[model samples]
Target: MNTKLMGSALIISGTALGAGMLAIPMVLAQFGLLYGTLLMVLIWFGTTYSALLLLEATIKSGGGLGLNSIARKTLGKGGQLLTNGLLYALLICLLMAYILGAADLLVQAASALGLELTFMHSQIIFTLTTGVIVACGTGVIDKLNRLLFFVMLASLLMTLAVLLPEFSTDNLSQVSNSDHIGLIKTSAVLFTSFGFMVVIPSLVSYNSEASDKQLRNMVIVGSIIPLVCYLCWLFAVVGNLPAGQLKEFASVSELMAGFEHDAPWVGGFLSVFTGLALLTSFFGVAMSLFHQNSDTFNQNRVVTYVLTFVLPLVGAILAADQFLSVLAYAGIILVFLAVFVPLAMVYKLRLANALPERYTAEGGNVMMVFALLFGGFLLASQVI
Candidate 1:
């Protein structure tokens, strides 16, 4: 693989796997192993397809602009404003979610070492760590992400390997009542889980020199890693937990805590891995948000720095206890902005240009309609 391709893959993979991994097992556990794994795959496809749609839109529009610019071009000024607002809100929510998760991990680590700290103190530490990383600039974040991505993959594999022996086929048979509710309720978690798709356009814009085939390949390869990781994680946790207990623990930390009680090293290792995963995500979002904000305000570094660093930390502190709930709620808005709207743009472009040679939609109107309907249904269900 080309060096740039490798770097892009790491960036994409790291961005996708962040924070979501920590919550996947618990989300999947709600619906049992088999069903949850299947749901995850469905989510992966939906998210990936949406991302491709966005990429197609980006390509047709000349490919340099970020999502906000594309939305403005396709949707007009009002549309642009709405999209920008949604993007900002979504980024803020994501920032808060990551910070909150990091703070929780730090607190857990401190508690494990017999040093009890208040949530605020932990939040401060988490914020500062993230701020320092952000302040170091994109080059530093990119470099760190490259190394951390490998460490993250290794830690994930190692943790999964240790838990594999304990996997139970009987647990896979158990199904969550929520799955019967169809994609609606399931989408709450799925949309949020797959929200990283929003970063795809940004990724494409960054790796502008990459060939079309290379971009597609990178996306496929990048997306698959997370799908496999999510499946393994679901298998490990869902198979290990009893059906009744699974409902009580809506967060992955609880499941990992159970594992930790039985296997301290495994739990500790996973916890650290989980923290790094969130950090990687935080870095990506911070970079993207900073870049977008900077571009919007005509590259005002001060505004970018302050918004990137401060907003998330404040949101995190305010939402320390309700981190997961906030994530679930944010999923509703994100599914529309991240998935639905972009799909529509792609479809519209496909029709306007009769099968254009470069960066065209694959299945024509049929695929476009499907993307629209599916994305719309997800958005509507969440609202109702």
Candidate 2:
């Protein structure tokens, strides 16, 4: 594989594998492993297709613009304004979720080592420690993100090794009759779990010389890796605990506590994996948010960094207990950016005959209609 392609794919995997991975089990517990897995596969396909749609629009506009610019070019000022607003809202929700998660992990780590720390202290420590790398700009984030991605994978494998032995077929056999309602409730967060499309424009800008094929490969490979990982995670969790026990976990800390109680040895590996997942995901979202601010403001770098991190940091602090809620809301905003915005741009391009000749997203007008209906279903699911 090209090194650039590998690095870029890691970015998408890293971003997609974050807080939503932590939150999925919470929503899926009542939904059962069989139904949850099917719903996830559906979402994976929907999100991956939407990402390719974004790629087509980006390529058509000459391949170096942000979503805001792409929206303006393809859909006019009204489109730009809507895209800009949704982009900021989505990024902030993601950052806030990550901050709260990392802080909880920090507190857990401190507790294991026989130290006590307040959530506020942990939030400050996590935000500043990771926030510095984000502030240093894309090169630093890219390098650190790649390194952490590998380390996170190592921890995931180790954690899985411990959990898979305890897996039972009986645990996986349970079914919920309300599977359809469960799918409706969980669709938003599940879709958000695959919400790496926000970084597609950044990937295009970072690899300016990358051919259209390479960009599409980045989205596909990057996203598919996380799909596999998430399934593995869901299997391990469901196979061990059964639906009733899984339903008791309201937060990541509680989930870790359940593992610790059942198999004491798994806690260490799971903690390491969870912490790395939060960090890698944080870098991807924060970097893209930083770039969006920099481009929009064209201000001093310090000012852009502040604009990117400050609001989310404060939101995280105030709502430290609301980790799952924040992720659920981010899923709502993600529907706008990931599905509707890209669908609109590509639809407009096709009507104008402005789509690039060499590399268009597959599936044609039929796919566009599917995307429209899918986006509406997710939005209505979350809202209703």
Candidate 3:
């Protein structure tokens, strides 16, 4: 049972660590280790707390309904619309980022294999292939996601191990010209790194028979693994690469190009690993989107799959080639759906006596205020 739960944990961790892993070191390099570590720790605790609140709510709802449906019952029509709309937007934006990341990594991998495909071709191929796997149904998605996630996670560890002997102490300690503004800016980017909460409903439904302890354990292990992975990734990448070289790339391709120029072997591993990372995330979000739509529309499986898969591909095509900016937007929406909604759901649950006396995530009214403030700070960052 623990082993089975661990796989679910790994799925959430893998989803959280993707796309953002490639950028975290550079983002943190500016803030330096002291501040960067502090911020991630706070964010992890807060997010973990909120995720448990979500778990409690999921458990209380008795597993028959999806998130939006539960919200409709607990939070009325406005809450339902807010969650349904923003959550869908968040997943679509995340899907777009993954598609873009995959295409870039695919081009690099193809060149190494001498396939020589164009960017457009790679993106289309990746989208269509992943789409088919997703359309197979949620069960297929669960199996494939586990396989891809562990592959990606293992490669990341291996890449870091290979690169370890070259790490410079000063590379991590070296101070850059960072200010409050830089930290805030990087925080906005890093905020969405812990976005596995959106998929918690899918996992709960998949393992509908799990106990409260089992559910809590997976959420903790699942979220903490990514938190540790991101920190270690920052340590390895920052300690190995100079600040100037690390920050030079505004894009993943350029960053990967720097890696190849500096260390060709490591770069080769990174390109492949990043590709798998993107695919794992793509599978995770796409699975959640498929299930969410399937439950909402009460439609045929084939139709829901097509609708879920097609929208993101179209969005990716229409979206700008940029990656980080989309994530920043996604983060704002994610915090609301993932972090903020739980506050309301739990508060409502407490008042209505929906929660059992044994529930662990019995959140306070004050926590809701803090969540609201934190979410507002994030929203204000986007506009200002």
By TM-score, who's the top model here? Answer: 2
Tens digit of lDDT per residue, candidate 1, span 336-383?
787777876776676687337767646777877777777776776566
Cα RMSD for predicted model 3: 1.9
Greater TM-score among 2 and 3 belongs to 2
Model 1, CA-based lDDT:
0.72
Error of 2 at 115 (Å): 3.1
In Å, residue 352's CA in model 3 sits off its true spot by: 0.7
- Model 1 regions more than 4 Å off: 114-116, 135-137, 176-179, 250-253, 351-355
RMSD of each: 2.3, 1.5, 1.9
Q: Tell me the tens digit of each residue's lDDT in model 3 across 127-214.
A: 8888888778656766776787778778888888778888789887865756766666665667788888877887887777678888
The residue ranges of model 2 lying beyond 4 angstroms of the native Cα positions read 176-179
lDDT of each: 0.72, 0.85, 0.78
Sliding window of 10 residues with minimal summed lDDT for model 3: 355-364
Per-residue lDDT for 277 in model 1? Answer: 84
Residue 349 lDDT, candidate 1, scale 0-100: 73
User: Lowest-scoring 10 consecutive residues by lDDT in candidate 2?
Assistant: 174-183
Candidate 2 per-residue lDDT over residues 1-384, each given as its tens digit? 588778989999999999977888778856777778888998999999999999999889775435777878888999888989999999999999999999999998998789999999998888877877888866676777889899988988998889877778787876543658656888988998998988888888888887888888888999999999999898888787867777767788999888877788899888988998988889889888887887677788778877988899999999978988898899999998999999988888888888457568988889988899889989888766
Error of 3 at 268 (Å): 2.3
The collision pairs in model 3 are: none
Pick by lDDT: 1 or 2, better one: 2
